[model samples]
Target: MTLLSVDNLSKSFGGLMAVNDVTFEVESGSIVGLIGPNGAGKTTVFNLITGNYQPNTGTVLFDGQNLVGLPTHTIVEKGIARTFQTIRLFQNMTVLENVLAGAHCRMRAGCIAAMLRTPAQRREEEEAMRQAMGELEFVGLGKEWQNKAKNLSYGNQRLLEIARALATKPKLIVLDEPAGGMNDQETQELITLIRAIQDRGITVLLIEHDMGLVMRVCSSLVVLEHGAKIASGTPAEIQSNPRVIEAYLGADSE
Candidate 1:
């Protein structure tokens, strides 16, 4: 079953075409990798799908609904969420607070209800906190739930972002270069956590430069070059594809 579908999606920034006729689908519970060289429009594809940039052409269907012009928050509310290439966190906020913030879109209590401090609102708040804590525990950040987001290590900060995104209860989560600057050990742990996220039955579509982690966790791989898709297949197929090697690892790496 397809949870998210990108059909002939294209985006442009003035004269440069950031993403051109890129298309891919993420199955309901599979982890799909979007990979490429630095200028390959990998992240551009993500932006178009998530509504950060409205596509000049093509369609984005999430759960069979057209998501073309929806705002980022609305898209997220429709069961798709994403983390940025850079860590976007509330630096001064507590870890629990960060996750709880993600839950805001799902909460039913209105501003009036919050201001009134109604019993119903109180119940809803408690439930939100419970869900946030569960996400934190899932990401191995339970012990630091009360700590400030600024206080955690960089790797832990990445995990915290995932925990926050999980708190949104998304059917599909998009991660951008999740293991970008991690050491080998941190990357290993991140790989395990990503698998755990997939095991929980949520679909994952990630843009990653770390091919090892991509091969380890993603059941499907989509390669991009110069803002267009160059390859799409399983990990082994991608590894052996001469074009991917020549475009990504360079012709000499083969």
Candidate 2:
């Protein structure tokens, strides 16, 4: 089943086209990789999907609802959550506090209810805390819940970001360059975490340059170059695709 359908999507910045007529679908309960070399517009496609940028043409359908003009928070409420290419944790905030922030979208208490300490608000707050802690534990940061986000090691910081995104209770999570700054061990752990996320029945869509990681985790891939989709298929098919090879390696390479 298609949880997300992006059709005829195109975006441009002034005169330069960042993404052009790209399309792909993310099936429910699958890990899909959107991959390309730098400047190939992989992130642009992500931005379009998550409502950060409006495309000049095309439609983004999430569970059959169009997401194009919706605000970012609305999109989150509609079950799509995303992380940035650069880690976007609240550095000064406690790790638990950071996760709680992600849960804010699902929270229903208004300022009046919160200020008055209504019974409903209290119950919601308790539930939010419980959910936040669970996400932290799931990402292996349960013991560091009280530490400031900046105190975590670089790789642990990445896990914290994922934990926070999970707190949103999204059906689909969009991860941008999730393995960008990790060592081999950290990357391996990430592979496991990603699989665990899929195991929990959340669809994962990611933009990653780490080919090995992409091949290992993604059931299918969408390849891009020069702001357009060049090819998309299983890992084995992409590996044998001459166009994908030429895009990553120079055409002159033997």
Candidate 3:
């Protein structure tokens, strides 16, 4: 049950290769981690998968369809939603408004329908509002629906990004460095939220440097170094892998 299959994916900026012939598969209903030290091209691989960048070689298949040249919005429409390594939120927008923006892809109302206040458009708007609130509640921000995005604490801001992505109704959500700026308590909460997401039957593929969080949540892991995949396996296997230790995890991983 592979939901995503990335084969021989490579991307280069000028002469420098950001990602090189990396291949990985994310199974449906599993939480997968992409790990490495900074500059290992983990985020670059994410960009390639989500259609922000086109790979120079190879194919990205989501549900058996190629996504190499699709626009980013089209990729989202195809059931793949992503968050940035840096939290990308509409800071000035209300929490609910931010989530509603993510629902735009699934919305069918055109400008004419919206302007004319057609019955179909009204129903769609109501449904989007309902979905947005549900996602906010799922992420523990239900009470803050009217708060501006910038008003949330740093960790909650991250959760808000996840909620927004969820509003897209994606089969797979790509999270880039989701635990980048969180304290221990917040990270623990994040671990719970991630598992809850999997419980909903959605697959998650994340780039995270937080090894503890990665180990706790992910059933499988792919390690990268120097823009290529070095090793991939279960947490226990990756923890004991010598090459992974030497490349990124270091001697203290044990």
Candidate 4:
């Protein structure tokens, strides 16, 4: 059931090691949390997995294929997709249009087909629109489908990013700090949306600092420090893990 595996992954810039010999597997249909304090190499791990940065040492295997040399878009085409720590959307495009852009990867109609208005192209376009609406609704943006991306509230903008990522039809979706900078109510709502994403049978690999939210949503947890995994387990076990507590949070401060 392992959809993705990271074996001895390490990355360095100049002489600084950002990620060091990290290894983990993302099981199919599970929500896995990668948690650590800032600069703990959490986002660096994500970039390595998603092919934004090729590791100096190690391999990323997706469905048994080596993904280390693949480009980002190629990796995405292999059923892996991700969102950023900062929400990245086409600010000038409508919500639906942004979602449709994600669908562009899977579209079969070429420029000629689109320009000629072939029946197959027309059907593909219609299906993409339908799927785009479904994605918007899935992320609770159904009402704002026609609005420009910049017009929505900050929380809704985050939801739009999730919807757009989902449009890629990835089997494994990596979210980097999906709840960053949200209010309490918005975080709660995001917690629910994340669970809904899991319920639909896609595996989620999340990088987050909000321990409370991580414990609530993730079925498994991985804690990292100075680029290496310090501890990993169920939320209860992680909360009590002496290493994680001392390394990430103050041992004296709960």
Backbone collision count in every prediction? Answer: 0, 0, 0, 0
Pairwise lDDT winner, candidates 3 and 4: 3
TM value for model 3: 0.99
Each prediction's whole-model lDDT (CA): 0.90, 0.92, 0.95, 0.90
Query: Mind giving the per-residue lDDT tens digits that candidate 3 earns over 1-254?
Result: 99999999999999988899999999999999999989999999999998889899999999999999999999999999988998999999999999999987899999999999999999999999999999999999999999999999999999999999999999999999888899999999999999999999999999998999999999999999989999999999999999999999999976
Better of 2 and 3 by lDDT: 3
CA error at residue 83 for candidate 1, angstroms: 0.9
Question: Against the true structure, what is each candidate's TM-score?
Answer: 0.97, 0.97, 0.99, 0.97
Query: 221 in model 2: Cα distance from truth in Å?
Result: 0.3
Model 3 residue 178 CA deviation (Å) reads 0.9
RMSD of each: 1.2, 1.7, 0.7, 1.1
Summarize candidate 1's per-residue lDDT along 1-254 as a digit string, tens digits.
Answer: 98888999888899998889988888899999999999889888888888888899999998999999899999989988888899999999999999999988899989999999999999999999999999999989999998999999988898899998999999899999999778899999999888888888889999898777888899999999899999999998888899899889655542
Q: Write the per-residue lDDT of candidate 2 for residues 88-192, one digit (tens) a residue.
A: 989999999999999988999999999999999999999999999999999999999999999999888889889889999999999998888989999999999
Name the best candidate (by TM-score): 3
Off by over 4 Å in 1: 251-254
Instruction: For model 3, name the residue pairs that clash.
Output: none
Deviation of model 3 at 195, angstroms:
0.3
- Winner on lDDT between 1 and 2 is 2
Q: Comparing candidate 2 with candidate 3, which one achieves the higher TM-score?
A: 3
